[model samples]
Target: MKKLHVVAAIIKKDDKILATQRGYGEFKGLWEFPGGKIEKGESKKEALIREIKEELNADIKIDKFALDLEWQYPNFYLYMSCYECSLESDLKLLEHMNGKWLGKDELDSVQWIEADIKVVNYLKENL
Candidate 1:
């Protein structure tokens, strides 16, 4: 199986975290934390910052490492590194169809992409 490395930002504001619905590709409409694949020679943090900027048009201050998860999809193995983050600017959705602010109690309210469910579960337990 192919292995993919990605970074996810659990962007928190007050008591809520940002969840975005995919606007394109195979995972369209599925909810996920707003970040993307790490680029060659980029540090995870750098990749995460760039991805959030590209995807949401927002800057973030990374607070801490939240989780490291490995999940198997039918075609690939996804290794995701999640971090707690705080948004530094207003958000403009460039790649997501929808965005929501969900509290810990509401994390399960959406249909998350398979791999992101693990991150949600971690947030539910630790938030």
Candidate 2:
């Protein structure tokens, strides 16, 4: 199976984590950490910063690496890196239908994409 390397930002503000809902394509309406696939030759941090800016219209400072996870979807294996980030502005959901700041108790209310669901579990355990 092919593997996709994705960099995801776990943007945390006031103890709440940012979650975006997919607005288009197959995963529409499913929640995910804001990010995109890492293009060839681009560093993970670069890809993450670029993706966040493109998707949310916000600048972010990557504070630390949070979690790395791998999961098999039906068509591909997803390798993801979760990073702790701080947003430079109020988030605007350009590519997503909506977004929310979720705490541990509210985590189950959102419908997360498969790969991101694993990351969410990790956060619940570790955070």
Candidate 1 ranges with C-alpha deviation above 4 Å: none
C-alpha lDDT score of every prediction, in listed order: 0.95, 0.91
| Each model's backbone clash number | 0, 0
Local accuracy of candidate 1 as per-residue lDDT tens digits, 1-127: 8999999999999999999999999999899998989999999999999999999999999999999999998999999999999999999999999999999989989999999999998988898
Model 1 quality (TM-score):
0.98
Q: Tens-digit lDDT track for model 2 on 1-127?
A: 9998999999999889998999999899899999999999999999999999999999999999998998898888989988999988877889999999999778889989988888888888977
RMSD of each: 0.7, 1.0
Best by lDDT: 1
